[model samples]
Target: MNTALDPTGATAAYLAKLPKGAVETAAHYTQGSHWVLVIGKLAAVVACLIILRSGILPRIAAMTGSRNRQNFAVFATGFAALLLQALLLMPWTFYADLVRERSYGLSNLTTGAWLTQSFITAVAGALVGGLLFIPLYVIIRRAKQRWWMWSSALLALLIALATVFAPYAAGLFNRYEPLQPGVVHDVVTDLARQASLSGEEIVIYDGSKQTDRYTASVTGVGGTARIALSDTVMRDPVDIPAIRAVVAHEIGHYKHHHLLILAGAVALLSCIGLIMAAFAFPTALRLLGGGGVGGISDASGIPVLLAISAVFTLVTTPVVNTVMRLVERDADAYGLNLAREPDGAARALLATTSYRAPSPSRLEEVIFYDHPSIESRLRVAMEWKAAAQGR
Candidate 1:
């Protein structure tokens, strides 16, 4: 990994000194956390299946008393399984999200606050999963052999719906307000105008309430679309040009409709994964002594389905991450042209190295990063500057 410090710029200099070992430590922590969560959740699913095979889930279903209670059983089973996974993974979550972030000086969240947030996240996930379980179970029972096809369609619809409501959903966790009149606000609005985005879409959010990360994003779809900057960006010693470059990058995402494309790609992947799961689930279940579980509809089959889906996702990670990296690189190019501040763009890229490695191996970048490495991004910025100067 290229860890060379930029020799000429204040922003780059500050970024260079941002707590050594953070990049490698963060990468190890992140990769370890991902595998730990995956293994822990898979184990929990197996444990839940064992409990189901022991007739606990059936007993729980019996309590609903025969008013077409299969739907109730499915929801209850899925929720219980999810809760088990959460419980099993809670220690990892705390260590990865709260402890590691604090150790790296990235997070400002107190333990209580972090716990509250975790609880909210867990409850929210359970609620959404339970609600979706009803329809999913219906499709499984009704479609029989074709359940995966319908489920894939349902997944796509859900992705679309989530995209539409994501901005509102995000507001539940963080506070947002308009960018107050200032140079940052002026630069942001100017970029919005240049990108044909509405000034109303530009806002500032209290991101520093949770993390010290300086960042921005273009989120939501249609009327919900928003350009938001973290309070860290507003207050951090980053120059106006760097801030503008960041905003321009976000605008590039919006201008290029990257969100729509991303959602579509994810939806397509969901379909492919579900199609694979359709073929894999029954065989896996039969081998696991779960043939007694009635087709895909049986609440007991949830673990097998989950396991298959997880494997499918794991296998496809490289393809999906590659697509995301390409999209991000396109946005970088657009931002460079729009902002006309390659140096600022390079500085902004460096600023994020507190957590992200300034350089990563090509294979590592392809497999793990959804965005281009800082080295790649800075190189693009420098090349753009060189070309522009030659002109």
Candidate 2:
């Protein structure tokens, strides 16, 4: 397996020639899309509240005479509202996921394929939300004041279950196959062995079917643990050594058990968010012209709960992003040490600059970037190279 670094500085020169304007244009689109999503979500929540307040939800509930039927009515109402919100957000989605990607030359998907995938995602989200909210409403109905605590526990369990089952869920979106035997395969397998992983744990997936972005991930835990590489990584423009370095970084994540650590952090935050929501929900509902704690389980209360949850998420974004960046830095360091290929790491970082800003401002990095910016990562790799050469 060839693990050689680029000897002539050619890769660095090529990366330097990559258009800064392209990066800026993509960033502008991305930032605008984020604000659009936030505003659209709030608008959707307001619409749901209005519909509920105008006697629509109550009339729908009245259509069902029995208690069980009424509960189903609540679920149906919330699900329909979520689907409506999704429809309202479709223009933003098209611009961000389809048009912007095409403009950046990063997407391979046709409009039909994009629409089909979007529909699938929306339906999946509605199903998941309905499953959770049914029990959530029951908890609110029965537990009253302590409902938040119980609901948080349920959320944590569901998150944990989702983490364990992620590989299966991911298969619904993309196709995976064993990587063909070759130099790339050999390098990946060797890295896997160094990371104490077996051959069966590595596979390549058809990521290029949707996007030109390069990505790899270690998904699931225990027997389900597997490392998946995007087909884009094995194609031209990304060299063999850089691909090896990327695999090493993913193995670092697996070796460090970052997935479980992240899951735990999210579970803890969910608990905190739920506690905050419990205190905030009654006041928020009153502000929305809805009844107080007595109506917590009402279909009208769903939007209030969601709106507060969104606020909690927005307020906590920095904390969550900080933790994620730290974990990513740890993986970068681990991969650098294990791969012993700083140039390869630098080249891999450069590949991402096609979509990510090469050198984001500190505030932008802190608030929006979950991974280290390309400049920061390349600097780290260069620093390591200097230290290693001195030794």
The 0-to-1 C-alpha lDDT of every candidate, in the order given, reads 0.75, 0.75
Error of 1 at 10 (Å): 15
Our tally of clashes for model 1 stands at 0
Clashing residue pairs in candidate 2 (N, C-alpha, C atoms within 3 angstroms) = none
**lDDT: worst 10-residue window of model 2:** 2-11
**Candidate 1 — which residues are off by over 4 angstroms?**
1-55, 236-238, 286-292
